[model samples]
Structure formats: C-alpha cells, structure tokens
Target: MRSEGLDLFAHGMIGLNQLKAGSLDSRNSLGAILGGGMDIQIWHGIYWRAFEADYVWAALHYSDVVSPSFPDLRRPYQNGVRLRTGLVFSYGEKKAAPMTAACSVQPTQVMVGEPVTATANVSNANPKHTLTYDWSSTGGKISGKGNTAAIDTNGVAGGDYTATAKISDPKTKHGGETSCSAKFTVKELPKNPPTLSLSANPTSVQTGGSVSLSGLSHQSGQRSGQWRQLDGECRHGFRKRQQRYAEYFRRPTRTDHRERKLF
Candidate 1:
C-alpha cells in the first residue's frame, strides 16, 4: 500500500488490491474483492482500474480430511485461488507559443557624417529564450547578439536607415521584437566651362582660292563643326577674295586645265 501510494504521488493515481481467502479443510476456496481504504494516495478519478490474480499451493486435503473422519469436501480451502492487480495511466499536456521578437533602430533622422545606433531589449521572456538581430527597418544590417550598438557614418550618408532585432527561445517558443531608424545628408560640387571666336574679312570667294583664317582656339565645347566656312566663321580678322569666270571657253562636254579667275 505504501508503494502504491508513492506510485500515486510520483505518477498521479493508482488502483491496488490484495486477495486472501480459503478455509482449513479438504479443498481450498477461491474469491476476490475491490477494496483499498482511503489510506491509498491514489486520487479519485475516472479509470478502468484493472484487476489482479495470484495462486499459492498448500497441503491441507489429506491432513484436515483424515483428522475429523473426512473434513467438509464442500470447502476447497487451499484448493482455491486468489488474484491481485493494479490500474494507472499517463497522458500529455497542451501546446505552447513560440519565442518571437523585433529589434528597433534609434534616431529616425540622420545626415552625412552622423552616428546611428540601435537596441535589442528583451520584450518578453518565459520558459527559455535568446536574442538575435533579424534586420533593420531601413533594410540596412543585422546584429548577432547584444542589447545596444553604435553605427558609424564614415562611408555612409544622405538616406534613411533602419535596424531590427529578434528575441526568441526555441525551447519555450516565444519572444519579443522591435526596430529603429536614422537619416543623413551629403553636399555636392558645381561646374564651370570657356568661349571661342572666328572671323574672315570678306563674305564670298572663288573655288580653290586661298582664304586667310583667324579665330580663338579654346577648349570650351566638346567638338567644332569649324569646316566649310559657315555663316558664323568670319567673326574676326580673316580675309577673302572675289571670284572670276571664263569667256569663250570649251563646250560643256570638254574638260579644261585652265584655272577660272576670280572677280
């Protein structure tokens, strides 16, 4: 019974029983019953309460029967049997939540050459837990583990950034998460580019005749369409000559080596 009670204490509940029945006559009797006083630590609960049985041998038939000129054959005292058994069961519990979390970055505003920082504080802790840097609100970076961190702006600038953190416990399946942010601004430089001039003294000239050219040679624009003497080519001191034509020349089909004079 003590063992049964301890079993009930350690494992919850239990059903225990012991059988002892028979007479001191020729044949033994058999019987069993469900009885365990309140002494059992087994709590009252719904259970099948399995039964048990056992049998032992003893010499009573010849000794008792031979004594009183034939003992009562009806009572099979030692010839009968007794049985004992126990009942108990085990079950599972319910499902729990997982550890989840978020990390937040600080200073939602920033400029070129400024420092930024983020923190991973434990928002919740139960059963078991751990912390991790999941990501940032600005899609920037992640931290391995820790509570706080400082960011450098040496090579970063002019934009918004965010940081995220995840505190979790794979065991208890629960956690807390958060995020933070910052901003920055960078300065830019200006541009300045030169001018040019060109000139030819006269407007018209004969073909194949030499024309003096004058102008400023500067690196202001990318390229120059300075050929063929356009309308704007004579802006300065360049010179030009008059043109002349031939009289009584060869027919249209004839080719001549004579240079047409300019007027």
Candidate 2:
C-alpha cells in the first residue's frame, strides 16, 4: 500500500508463498511476509524519518501418523517484526571549471605595421561545458571570440608587446576564471646604408714628392678608414695607410713609378 501527497509519502509490501503436501516429511510450506514504511520530504528530493517493519511466518508442517504423542516434526513459528529507520540523502558530484589558461602568439618577432594572431589554451575545464573568452593587449588592436584573437600592429611603436586571454566557464559551480599572457617583439623599418668617398688633391706628382689624400663619409659620427695605392703596367702592391683625415705619401722612386689609381 502507498499514499502520495505534496509533502508526505507512505508505502508497503507483502510476500506470497505456496507449497505442495507430500507423503514424506518435507520443509516447504505456505507462509506470509509483510512490510510497510513511511518518509517525510525534508528538503528538495531528500527525505527523513524513514521507517520499515517486516513480519515472517515460519511454522507449517506435515505428520506421518495420527498419534498425538508423536513430537511436532516442523520448526516453531517465528512471530517477530523487525523495524528500521534512518535519514536519506540525495547529492551529486561538483561541477568542473577552468583552472588555468595559457596563450601563444604566432610570429613573435615582426616589423612595424605587421599583424599577429593569438590563441588560447584552457586547462581543467569540463568538455561538455560551454566557455567564453575575453582578450586584451598592451599594444595594438585586438579582436577575439571564444579562444582565438587577432592583433593589428599598424602604426604601432617598436618594442616588446603582450597579449592576454581570460577564460571562464559559465556553468562552473564556483564561477572561477583564469588568465594567461603571451609576448611578442616589434622593430622599426631598416634605414639606408652609410657611404664613403676619397679624393687626392694633386692629380700628378713628381718622383720622390708627396701628395695630399683626403676622404669623406656620408654617415654622421666619427669615421676611420684605410688608403692604398696600386701599381699599373704590371700590377703590383704598393704602400697603404690607416687614417681619418688627409694623409701625405711619397711617390715611389723605383722603376715602376708610372701613374696608377689610388684606392
């Protein structure tokens, strides 16, 4: 038997048994088993004050003779109702959430006015749970959704920059979040190279005489260079000097004293 209500409940059970009579002594016989219990709804799906009672019949037998002096061949009747009651609980496992978040940037080094992409990797998150992402950066413009974002470096200054990703699981029990960052480097465009020019004051010089040699550097700042003279008609090595300003060199008086280009 059972009764249902908005806040209370009751239930019961009964066991049925049967057996055949035999010419010889046998143990199988008719019996009855009955049980009943009731519980109160203490909280949402949970119940308290649950109790149950069970009664079992154990005395039925057969006789081989009609004499009353013979001892009863079957066991004595068991007439006790066992009762039990306790508190009942209902619960479930806690929800998993995002514990740690990490991110990475592609092409970590780039020139000004370049582009980079960032991706996020989350840990300790439930596979079936939905997640949302928020992205930020210390330099450049950022656009993102879920676990991915883009960084535009147009008109951005040259230096190291960082991008961050914040991850959250909306269905988490604790409403926890994690954040991670990635770094990238940027450099300005290259500049034109330096240049050098050399000139000799006297186009021609007499044997055993010296000529004034000078040079200029297109690049600003202190400069140091080398000057060298080459022999012609039968190419041969000559004198060389290391200087910053004008340098005087005596013309060679040897047999190969012909005019030649100075480098």
Candidate 3:
C-alpha cells in the first residue's frame, strides 16, 4: 500500500541563553509526507506492519538573540525521514462465493424397470472439504453416491417425475449448500399385441409360376417388426420395410403343386 498527504510538524530548540533564562521557543510547520509499507498476515484480520518509511519536507523559521544586543534570523526548508513497524488491525468480514448446482439425467424417458442415471454438477465448492449428496425423487427410488446417482424406475406409474439432489459442504455452516432437479418420463407397456395381415397376388398359381406376396403389421406404440419367411427357397426373395407404426414385407414365391405355410 501507498499513501501521500499533508502533515503537521512541531519544532523546538534550546540555546545556552535560553537555558540560563530557563525558557525555550517552539514553532509549528506544515509539511507533506509520502510513504509506503509492507504488511504480513499474522492471523485472520491481524497483520504485522513489517516496515514503513516516510519522506517529509517542511519550511521552518527561527530567530536567535544574545542579550538583546544583536539578533540573527533565518528561514529554511528541511527534509526528514520517519520509519515505523507495528501490528495492524483489520475490521469487518470477508464474503464467500455462493454455491450452485445443476442436475441432469441420461435417457430422459424410459420404460418401466429400466434404470435412469442422474448427475449433479456443482460450482464454488471448497476442494478441501468433504461434500455430501442427498438424493430424492417424486417417483421411484433414488440412490446417490457422490455427485452421481441411479434411479430405479420399477413399479413406477407412467408419468412425468423429478429427481433432485442436494449438495453440501460439511465443513461450512452457511452458504455452502445447494440443490438442483431434473425431469424424466416413464412409459408403460402396450396393452395389446400388434396386428398382422398377409395377402398374395394371383391366389392360384400353376407349376413353376411366381406369386407376389405382401404382409403388413400394425402396432399402437413405437415398436418395430421383423419379417422371416419359412420357405428356404423363397427366403432370398423377401424384402422388409420397417416403421415405428407399421411394417411391410414383400416376397415372390415359386410353387410346384406343394402346400406351403406362411407365418
């Protein structure tokens, strides 16, 4: 730190004649002081002023008389130095950074009995202190360890839910706790099985004749279907068109007066 400001100085002198008369003269002068210092911390709010030095300049006037017979007067500008070292006391308190947290979940939507992972990201936490995490949810059971946790979605109803995590620093009494929440959805299984249909072009075919076969499948939910032809000879001719709501399969068959079953 550094400082520069106006100062006041008082000067006094004692001469042989003044000593015999048991008297002295004093004068006050105005000056400017410039100085800087170094401080080392001894403890919280307490510091040791290692060293401080100041340069002072002032204008002084004086007069001398011997027995009132003759007199001499002079005016002069003087320079002075001052050094100091001591303990310094500081007041008030220091503020700490506020704690904050953010929560997120992997796979925001899941089917029942599937596991969901929740994570907590924290900021402004003390690295030296041990942190504790508390996990909770509106639905399902949540278990947490450190910053991450797992949620068991089994037996949970089909609806939207929230997972929350509370983070805290055990060493701090105040301003060291934070909480965050994330949302997720649970879906139930479909009530009915998917519907299937099959058709063939040219219902009757002669020997070695090719018949075009088409099949369709419909489902209520987001599900895909696969197609498999039972006939080994016609398996290579089967083509599948996959979709979330419906699926289509096409194949061309060659028959030779033998009965064939399609599934």
Candidates in order have lDDT scores of: 0.39, 0.64, 0.68
RMSD of each: 21.9, 15.6, 12.1
Q: Please give, for residues 1-263, the per-residue lDDT of candidate 2 as tens digits.
A: 32221234334444444444476444555566666667665654566756767676656554543355645644335466778787766477233343788899998988788899999988887677788898999999999978999899998889999999988876654545788999999876645333456676586766655666655445422223344556543122123334212242232122222333334
Top candidate on TM-score is: 3
> Which structure among the candidates has the greatest lDDT?
3
Off by over 4 Å in 2: 1-98, 193-263
Judge candidate 2 at residue 134 and give its lDDT.
89
The residue pairs that clash in candidate 2, if any, are none
Give lDDT tens digits, candidate 3, residues 1-263: 31111122333433221112235456555556676667776665677778877776765555453343333325556678989888888788464678899999998999898999999999988877789999999989999999999999999999999999999887766687999999999988666544566787887666566667755545444334454545544344444222321322233222222232333
Report the C-alpha displacement of residue 71, candidate 2, in angstroms.
Answer: 26
lDDT of 2 at 104: 97
Assess candidate 3 and give its lDDT: 0.68
Task: Evaluate model 1: give its lDDT.
Answer: 0.39
Candidate 1 local lDDT, residue 250: 17
Q: What TM-scores do the predictions have? A: 0.31, 0.42, 0.54
